[model samples]
Target chain A: MTIAATKQFCTFFVGGHYFGVPVLDVQEAIRYQEMTSVPLSSSVVSGLINLRGQIVVAFDLRRRLELPPRSDGAKPMNVVVRHLDGVVSLLVDEIDDVVETDEVTFEPAPATLKGVAREVILGAYKLKNRLLLVLDIEKVLSIEAITSGDGDDNAS
Target chain B: MTLVGELVLARNQVLQFSATQSDPALLSATQQLNLLTSELQESVMKTRMQPIGKLWSKFPRVVRDLAGICGKRVRVQMEGEDTELDKTIIEAIGDPLTHIIRNAIDHGIEEPAIRTRRGKPEEGKLSLKAFHEGGQVNIEISDDGAGINVEKVRAKVLKQGLISPEQLTRMSERELIQLIFLPGFSTAEQVTSVSGRGVGMDVVKTNIEKIGGSLDIHSELGKGSTIKIKIPLTLAIIPALVVTSDSCRYAIPQVSLLELVRLDSEIAFKSVENIHGAPVYRLRGKLLPLVYLSSVLNTGSAQLNQDVASIDIVVLQADKLQFGLVVESIKDTAEIVVKPLGHHLKSASVFAGSTIMGDGKVALILDVVGLAEHAGLASKVEAIAASNLAGIQNDSTEGEKLLLVGVGDNSIAIHLSTVARLEEFPASAIESAGGRPVVQYRHGILPLVDLADFTGGYSAFSQNESPFQVVVCSGPHGIMGLIVDRIIDVVQENIQIQLIGERHGFIGSSIIHNKMTDLLDVHAVISSIDPSFFDEMKEALIGGVR
Candidate 1:
């Protein structure tokens, strides 16, 4: 049997679903900061945030996933990550701990997933209590996909 | 460098925090930190600069090869090779400079036989010079060869049907030479491999302008041509004016800023007028088109609020068009470090980039040209102004052209040949010298003549805040300014003077442009202002003191 390699992921929650991205790709997680809204941008672009003097465009994960809107008065956390061009922040409901899992527990993404989840979910990792959906950050942050959607929802 | 920018921002934040603290120790430390951070930022910026010689090193070979192909003899000479520019600008200018050099050799320089026949040296000289001027870099490429032929350009323009014969006759020689920069315009007898594929000069102009540089050409009939380019030193940092609209702050680059005007509610209501639906303000004697920032950005319909206590206008120049941008409030000016936006937001034409404010918030920087395009004002206003002038010019062409001015309720015309220039001066700039209103102009004193007061019309001269619209005229004594209420239109039509009763400051009355216009005797008006003015000037001239 081949030696089992372990991979670590920084996890977060959005619309009651567990999601994780490779730990190396994650920059940092911070509390909700004030955002300066862009007027005519796409719907998924929540606004721009100042992360210690660096301007980072924040994308709302709930809207990107086509899930139900978060309830009123609930502040979203910022999950900053590195991209090919620059740094971007993903707004999620809550932050979770970094989890380590063996490669043996990894499995291909199931065919049952629908909507945008099927496009951005790479695969899954079977944990002791539940399944952790692995997010493809490149596909999730695709410039073409973000700009080509029907921009109707107002994030402001 | 980005880390240095972040440090600068952090230091700014610290300075702001220290403003609230009264402790001497912390305040002194913050001041020291601010000084050190600024020095460090300057040092880092210097490291990014490289000598422009690095980019020009390969041009001699290019010139040699191009000269050989065209059967011309050209020698390359470069000056100020050590002139330093930002590394990015050095890289960006390489191709455009090469293209200009190629054109100088291929089109500007004459062949060896032609140069010998014209009594010029067989070897044509191509010189590249660079220097620093007015806080910017200037590069000039000149060649001593056959210059642009204005007659040939005019014929080519007509052959291409670019303009009508009447319009062509109206164009000056310099304007005709500028037609070479038009797209798909070439005066070459035949297309050659080295240049003249009908795509050279226009692309060169566009590429240079993209980097905030301007290109101008000067040529004589056979002396040669020189192309001068002026560009800013660096693009990483710029001074910008900050303003708020719908509570969102935006930064406008200071390069495009002309002046700021603040109008109180009372004056704003009377001064700002609407023509067809576009709002315009009478600045001096000219009509300035006004653009509302709120409506352009779609932030909110804040422009419809007629109860605003005051109006703040930021005059901006975008390309050849100048318009006033109305914002909600004016904030302080700051030196901002530019950062590019993410790729997803690149399609938004209005925003140039994003910058971090002193308060650690992100603010969007506006691209003036893109904003003008998005608002659909650049072409529309130009078309309207052009059509208005064209309609008047097409009406008549028989009599002398006259400048029409409005004095209170009367329209008066002055011979265009006698008018020196039109100028506008603020009311505050008018000072009293020897009990006469005079202003310092061109290193001399220009006396003011109030036409309204002279003609015994309704005198609005008491308002010290409104600017004076003056028509400058050269009298036998000196230059004098005739202050009028506004300037109407210029029309050329046969004069049929209807001699009315002798009126002060009026020679006779005539019907022009369907209005009763009085022909003003300029000499008589000047003499009436100060009877001794002409005598003093004549004495000075005779004494050889002038």
Candidate 2:
């Protein structure tokens, strides 16, 4: 049998879930910076952060994924990613190592996984330690999905 | 270009860091870096600058083809072809410029035969002139052809029911000519394949304004029309006024900023009054509407310093409507590089974009027009200024200028021509004389009439400790004060009395500002209060004649 091609992904953690975005899509990951709150924006839009000199909108992945609020005083790290519109930073609980997986262990997202996770999660790679969820970065950052139903559940 | 922007920001950070250092060598090096960075930035920006002639080079052919289609003989001329503009601005203005050229050939220029009959050259002259003035690029497109017909524009506006004939009469000829820029307004008696679907000029105006530019038109009846556009040198950077509200900073573009007014605690309390829940300030005899930035943004902050010891008002003009924006404080003005907001926050229309301040913090930029719309002030102002088109008509003789006032729940209009001045008298200063209320005025006793008594409405002065809003007018007897609950607005409207006087003091009722406003008969109201008020004046005049 022929061996499957390997794909690399930059990994991060939010709400106990391990997520991976294609390595090429990741711009950089840095410590949390001061954010200017947008008063009337969607709940998932954490705020605007100064990335070098560029103003990047920060999205809270916990709320975006419908998870409980982060513990008090725990600052989220920014996972800056290139978007078609501009650069946006996804606030995650912690950063993980880049993971490489082959198509042999890949499985499409289960039909039973419902709600927003069903939409943003492309598939999973069964790693030796745990399962790595491959995130569809485009769908995750799309403005329409971020603002539609269940988006405003935890905004306040 | 973005890399250059990043370099400039890095240099700024380094300069800021070196400011606290006492080392002379390091300080000198930082200064050298700052100066060199500025020079380098300027050089990089110059690389993007192209002579505007690059865009106009193809206009002659456009003019030729368009003139051929219109069956007109036109000569195209260009001046200042070497004048330069940013590449982006050159690209942005291309379509609008071409549209203007097409409009000139199609509608502006008369045919060759008509040009000869007018005793002029057989060919019409179409000139495009470009120059730099006041740190802006000025482009003028002029055509020596049949000029804009003010009469035609007025007739079209009337036919479309965009304005009433009465309002049309009050509009000046220049204002009538400008009506062509209104959306869906086309004066091309016939819709030709070329330019006159009524969509070009309005879009042209909006496109120019989007880049911090302004468009103006000057046309003569038979001479021609000149469309002049003034655009900023670049759109990447703009001068903005920084302000704070709810402890957060925001930037307002200087192009929309008219002026800044700071009112002391006492003046603020007295000058800012509430009219039907909307706060308005009497600015130099004009009623300027006020919008609180914190309230509009719903920042969850305590409502606008309720006790407002002092206030800062940023007077801004949005879409020709001027309003005062109340903020916590006014910071210094700075030239900021504008950056776009992410798609997540794009629906928040109040913010034009976000910018990084010198301290490396992101501050949202306020979109004046959007903010006004969000506050619901734009539509309100548009309704109140329905005849705003006649705002430029300073001729009071054309229409009756009325001072609209609120008396209880009713609105009343008093002829502004008869008003001597508007005065606010303390309620404590009121004294009674022969069962009539009066106040001591400029060394003489000025009789006061309660408008509520005439209209049978509740008196505001009697309920509160607030001062009486007195409209001072001079009759044959002398100046008398008419006490009203609140002073609404001064508008120049054609009074078409729809209902005759149904009450004692009201002359009649008319639909003013889309409301049934009673026209107050000042003489009758004064006579109802004091029968001898005008009789005494008559006795004095007869004595003088004898």
Candidate 3:
């Protein structure tokens, strides 16, 4: 009679997401071709990419999980992983493959979750019937949330 | 003193010549002091003379010991004693060429009966020459009599308010003898010790520019004063150009090199111009402004549209001020060597030493007037207040009809720095600069500005293959050319950048073959293309040619 139960998740769909990032935080996945924009950066980054040659940045993460605008047309896919000392890629709206098993498959995050995509998800995976959620991509690739409020420029 | 007492009396005339002879005229004065000590050992292996005429032969023996203590006669002529320099430039032109030949023989050679009514004759002529011109080394120094009196230099260029008797009646008797070299100044009329305590001609142009050199003075009223002096030929070999920006690489000097264009990716977005975000460059016809060596250091770049399509401006020049650096290419001119940078980098005024380069690496050099006085740039009224804070304006964008697009991924193009040519426009029409609509884009108003904030932003477009343009970016702080959506095939590729995040405002991601490419801050997009774009324009853009 020993059971605490409560952990089990696998979700995917980045930037429109069923969301769930942590099949051991990825590490390898490649698709986007040339990406290299970072000039005077900080507008949610979406720039530097070259995974195999190793420069990596590609951030968008659905504008870091405000989570609506995704298939601008689909061909860009990088995903890579790691971050910090190096390796970053995030852009995603496509690589859906891995799905192991977890803590009774999470559920405790409902109360409107505080906003800005609730800092990018932490618990929810109903599955079978279909809810998923979870994802936290290192606090959604952090840098104080891609330069926060951008001092102003949503205008477009 | 007499060449170290004639080298100990020519080694005591060869040790009192022991030919052990019976006084053949004291051994012919010791064989003419062994032929004057072998012509002072072949005049110390011929040429490069110094001891500047033994410091102007101790000033004609202190002007014949001050014309016998100021009864006055002075006569001193000495031309640049074989102009050899560096023994700390003959100990810095030996006391300002001896307080300018004792202020031209104590107040310009007058007495001898006031030089026979100032037609000047009684012993006047004091001289000194020192040549090697242009790459600097001059020395001049003249004198005749009286001179110094343009109504006492327009009453001392108007009692030192430094001009305005309508600028001393619009100066130029050689700018009225360079208003007697400013600093404290003195038209004499009294206070003397040989010269007024106003420390004569601004300490003779501050000790001939403390050895870097530049002093000018030319008087003529009663005809006399000349003082020239220029310096720089080798404080250790300089020459430079190297450049790289953000991933750092700097050097720039070919004595302020003047050319190195390159702009490729179809001329770096048609040569760049933003006016309202400042970054202009109409160039040959005039509108130049644009800086970005990485906005003084903010560093950035991981990718920014694969360097917007070719870049490498350079241009330099200094003295009258002529800017353009914009690099990521130009590499080689190096005669380098220099070294300095120590005393805690002599006040980091943007460096001027640390050379090494032929692959040995080091690099540093730049000072471009301490990086245009540390990027506030210094003048054309601080470059039209940094081109009206990089928004630049001469009425073009308002007159509308602007077209400079270049966005790749799916692709977008059109660039014309001023092409009376290259006009295609239909990526199915395109529209964004103001018809905005979440930008599926199309139908006119082509030109754009976000070149990562025009010239002084995107972390200073870090350059290597440097490029950036959220919009069409003309050049030099206004509109020079930067419409690029891919021309990424120029084949001379050879870079490295990738430091990873954080340093991304100027340089930290550029490695080509192993692959990483984001380095475009170009001084935060030329300071966001302009705040008013150098104003004074109810009329300039058409100068770039309608």
Candidate 4:
């Protein structure tokens, strides 16, 4: 039987940091539309948008990464991906096109990632310039983890 | 009132002035009251209860959640945004109302692209309107989306095993929606934050019902849906009637009861009959099954046979069960404040809750439908109604004997089943339909074959219980009383063959009784006499003299 090979995803940067989400999960990249707030959900779970007939929930990856909160004024773009039994569009600073890497070059995690942001990072991807943090877009945007007891404010 | 008010306000004023006028050190340490009425008013205004619409600002949220699931665009429009409710009640109605809005978006509202395809506006309109009416507030949430697919509900109900296929066939479309409230009934393949957890409608109903409220739903395919809620303005007081049954006091809501009728033993013995040991009354020509309160409570029958031997029949209408509850007497209707029953008393579903009467007596509020449900007699009521309708459909075919018998000077009517056999009495087999005086000659509607109505100029006299009347001993399901003049031979016929509409006794038989008579609509007479009397009930007109 003829074997089909999976495509290698490109590593990219936003604000001078490396990150990568699976190209397979990502449907397309688009500039932001008006996002409506989902009041009863977690802070990281931002809101939803009526995107071309499909209603997509948009989660803020910056908040999930525990970086400084974005000001309400930031005009960001969204990386739309199918997740959580439904499609979600991630509100991010930027997106990059595919760049090839050998699947054999994958590495394991060094030690404990046993903190709040551990599940967010899949095994790190090392690139020539620097390390490209492999982002587990599914885990980072999970409603359960985002709204757990460890949070400052209970989501529900 | 002024002195007490002055003391508190003045004390606060002193504290406030002392705090503002003194040195900073003393101000930090302690201060006397200095209450400007404006300051107090300012604080009150800060807490000044605004309309409950302050909470309604959350619907866009629900629309978003639902839109995410249904992949639709729903714009929520709210009116009566200034409607006010108690803070506590608002807190309770908020989550439930959100769920309703979400369901409306996810289920009622069709997909946005689908909308464009249907040649309709792409943006769906959802309105949440609340207005005060009567002593309660009515909240309505409607959506200009696809209404509930009644077919989908029917299929889902059967698929979810909520009801059998046979049941689905007979259920009205409205009944199909009711399946949504059957605890854990649902059809969604995947659970979502927006509806389909299975407890949505039931939770809404229970919460609303708890607050002395009710909900009504209206929907049509392709248009939209509306869920209207009726909730009391306040939980402080409600109209309730105090009644006694089996020596225990119950608060029956005046709203649900039809009327209270007094049945004296004198009239009771005449109208009430025992059918298969169950006492039923011929109320308005139909047999109404009598529910004695004492028996339902397992406390034995109450003594209704007092001075006048009176029994109070409290007529009730629950859903569809039109029943008469036999109680002692209705004391009075009063506005009573209800208190929740503690944990131990919660298991008693019969009592929705407990309330203190004006006389300080603790009375349990009766949940009439709950009692009928507990007894598993809800469908029995359906059987009664079906039989009544069936009675009308097969009128002349009612296969029971509307017997005509000779009284002193006239003919009287009786049920044939009550009469064993008639023989030539030689004028001595005379009996009464009761103590009524009529013609004495033995022939009656039976003698109409012999043309017997002309011998009516005879003298009349009374003969106790044994008069010349058709002996009607009240058959099990048909014909109870014997309105007889004298005994006449029994001849059976397929009752469907009604005697001609004119004054005739038996079919094709010219036997004319003293009174004008229509052929007994046998099946009707049978079922009307007692619904339990038929052999499949509909088999009534079929059972004539073979």
Q: In order, what are the TM-scores of chain A for the candidates?
A: 0.94, 0.92, 0.35, 0.80
lDDT score for candidate 4 against the true structure:
0.60
Give me candidate 3's TM-score against the actual structure.
Answer: 0.23
Model 2, residue B418: what's the lDDT? 80
Distance from true location, Cα of B438 in model 4, Å: 38
By DockQ: ranked, best first: 1, 2, 4, 3
Per-residue accuracy of model 1 over A70-130 as CA lDDT, tens digit each: 8999999999999986899999999998999889899989899887899999999999998
Each predicted complex: what DockQ?
Answer: 0.59, 0.46, 0.01, 0.01
**Share of true Cα-Cα contacts across chains kept by each model:** 0.70, 0.84, 0.00, 0.00
- TM-score: the better of candidates 2 and 3: 2
Root-mean-square deviation per candidate? 8.9, 13.1, 37.0, 25.4
- Candidate 2 wrongly placed segments (more than 4 Å): A1-3, A128-130, A147-156, B1-4, B14-54, B75-84, B103-134, B138-228, B301-303, B343-349, B386-546
Candidate 4 lDDT over A122-155, as tens digits, reads: 7765667666667777677655676652224323
Best by TM-score: 1
Over A21-117, each residue of candidate 2 has an lDDT whose tens digit, in order, gives 9888899999989999887677888889998777899999998888998999999999999998578999999999888888789999999999989
Docking class of 4: incorrect
Top-down TM-score ranking: 1, 2, 4, 3
Q: Encode model 3's per-residue lDDT on A44-115: one tens digit a residue.
A: 555554333234556766666665565556765766767565567677677776654456666777878887
B1-546: candidate 1 lDDT, tens digit per residue: 777777877787788789899999999999999999889988877998888888889999999999999999999999999988888888888888999899889889999999999999999999999999755789999999898889999998889887799988977677687788888888888888877688878888877765656677899878999989876677677788999988999999887788999999988978887765678776643567888998887777745467988999999877567888999999989778877788878877778788888888889988787788778785457554665576524334367778999888888898887799998888898987656787767877788888887567885765758887889998877788888888886667678888898987778999877888889889888878677864654564467554
| Chain A TM value for model 3 | 0.35
Candidate 3 per-residue C-alpha lDDT over B1-546 given as tens digits, one digit per residue, 9 for 90 to 100: 223323533343354443656787767776776666556633542333354566676778877776666677767777757666555567766887788777777777677778877666777777877777656677787888777776776786577676668757755466576677777777667785567666777777767754545577677767777777766654544457677765546677676567877677866666676554556566643566667666544454422245455777787755456777676666666445455443223345556655444333345667676666566554342445456567633333122121322233311112222223223233333333322211222332234433333223333222323333334344444432333443332112334445665642344444432344454544444444453443322123345345
The stretch of ten residues in a row with the least summed lDDT in candidate 2 chain A is A147-156
